[model samples]
Target: MAKQRKIIHVDMDAFFASVEQRDHPEYKGKPLIVGGQPNSRGVVAACSYEARKYGIHSAMPCSRAYRLCSHALFVPPRFDAYREVSNQIRDIFWRYATEVEPLSLDEAYLDVTYTEAFNGSATLIAQAIKREILQETRLTASAGVSYNKFLAKIASDMDKPNGLYVIRPEQGEAFVAALPVGKFHGIGPATETKMHNLGIHTGKNLREKSLTELTERFGKAGQYYYNIARAIDERPVRSQRIRKSLGKETTFAEDIHSIPELTAKLLDLAERVFESLSKQNLKARTITVKVKYADFQQVTRAHSTEHIIQLTDLKQIIPLLLEKTEAGIKPVRLVGLSMSGFDVPVLQTHQPQLDLALNDEF
Candidate 1:
């Protein structure tokens, strides 16, 4: 028989807000929001647990969050500071297991199946890591221990604000069966509504459908849902995750109809995207622009070249790309810019092409 894998998913409690509270002790007990100003057209990046009590959450408009709690502290994100702390936390993960897959700056998955630490007790290792994090960084973390990545991730979220939950091998199916279908990790609001319409309210209800029935309904994702309903996820914890693309997007508080405003927004997004690309020392041959209409319709236009893309090239190309979209005809609510096609090395031999060609349709 194959050895069961021991996976642990660790997530920091209110990561960005907690870091702010730790750095600025006066903000400790108060409801804090980490994002843009209330008057700005920005969403909350992160909010403190205290803020959550007021119904404030990440991705909600800062203005809405302000209305929820006028007394809540609103502050911009300190990405540099957060990245530093995340590095510190990542160091702690490395001390326990070699197979660590970081889901984000605040959460990661660690496969400790073969780790001999603490007699290979995954729960003990989780406790030690949490204790060390508290001792070193004065921050609290939650951990979930299970035999697979999906269960481990769900277990981490079961208890919040410095909680540790475990799902044993024999108990996995029962635990999943009792869980609401909406609570499944991959099921979004739209998918949950679809499942509910089909009388699949919980894991048990989901497991009743055959593989063919699920596949016919959810396409490829149907198979995933069917397996997770039975607590079966065989995915490994991949440590080295290669980034495929870098992008930045903005959602306006009000829809914009002017072509000039849309072009300006696209330009700003391109600058931010290019800055991030430069920080990563990566180059791209393709640039994509996405526009979401006020009616919720979305479209994208892309351009590719034989040479590496530059900010100057983006400035010239964005206007032409925008003309292809219905932004001026339809009110645009969101605009995004992204750079991809980084598989080629920076020094790869390619004939310099002058023509700007629209190649990709994504």
Candidate 2:
């Protein structure tokens, strides 16, 4: 017989907005949005529980969400703070497993099959980890324990905010069949609508569709759906990889329409550029300026240096902004500055202990 598999997925509750509310008590219970301004092609990065009550959610255009929740408090994103918290959570996850795969800032999958705590019980290990996280972080996390990635991630969301759900090997398939198609991870609104027309609204319905027909309709993802419908996700958890980029962008307090005002904007952006580079201990030979125009046309310009980054590079490149602006420059709306080639000091691996702080609710 094949050995029982053990996996756990833990997701932080409403991560970005929750962090905002946690830091500022006054912001709690109020509709809070963290993203760009509503009118300027902005998108919702996160929303508090209160904002969600108005049907506002992440990735919805801020303009549309503004209409839905006018009372919402719109705040710019604090990605720096969010990244710090994500590191802390990542540290906690490594306590139980070497195989820790992060999906994003707020969620991850841990392969605990080799951990001492498993001892033939993935469910018990998941429960203990959830409690430990709450104790250490003063934040709640929902956990799902299953034999594979797909069912485990699905189970994590089944009960949210602060939940521990377990899908045993014997019970997994029945659970998948009863699930709604819309609830599957990769099934988005467009595909769900297509599946609905085919009278396949539930996992069981999709199961009845022949594998070939499902593939014809959904392409390669249909194969993924087929395995999921039967709770047969075979993907293994892996460790986090180094991040790709670390940069920042800005929108002027007011739009810059003229030739001269735009140059001054670059000066302000140059200051921000140097600041991020200094903090991250990076010397980027590449500095990119992202320009958004009044009509929303955009362009990018980059200046590379073989030498280490210095503020003097900005002085040299600021002169070239006008020429870069020519092609797409229709009354420049917003300007942003970014520096790449940052690397984290990867030698900082330590075996962290679980720092649990629990309120102990029965």
- What TM-score quantifies how close candidate 1 is to the native fold? 0.88
Work out how many backbone clashes candidate 2 has.
5
Deviation in angstroms for 262 in model 2?
Answer: 13
The TM-scores, one per candidate, come to 0.88, 0.69
TM-score, model 2 to reference: 0.69
**What is the lDDT of every predicted structure here?**
0.89, 0.77
Off by over 4 Å in 2: 37-41, 118-120, 240-362
Model 2 misses residue 132 by how many Å? 2.0
lDDT score of residue 150 within candidate 2? 85
> Candidate 1 on 1-362: residue-level lDDT in tens?
34467889999999999999999999999999999888877889999999999999998879899999999999989999989999999999989885888989999999777666787788898999999999988999999999999999999999998999999898999999999998999999999999999999999999999999999999999899989999999988878776788999988988999988888998998888988888888899999999989777899999999899889997789989999999899999899999998854433222222322322110
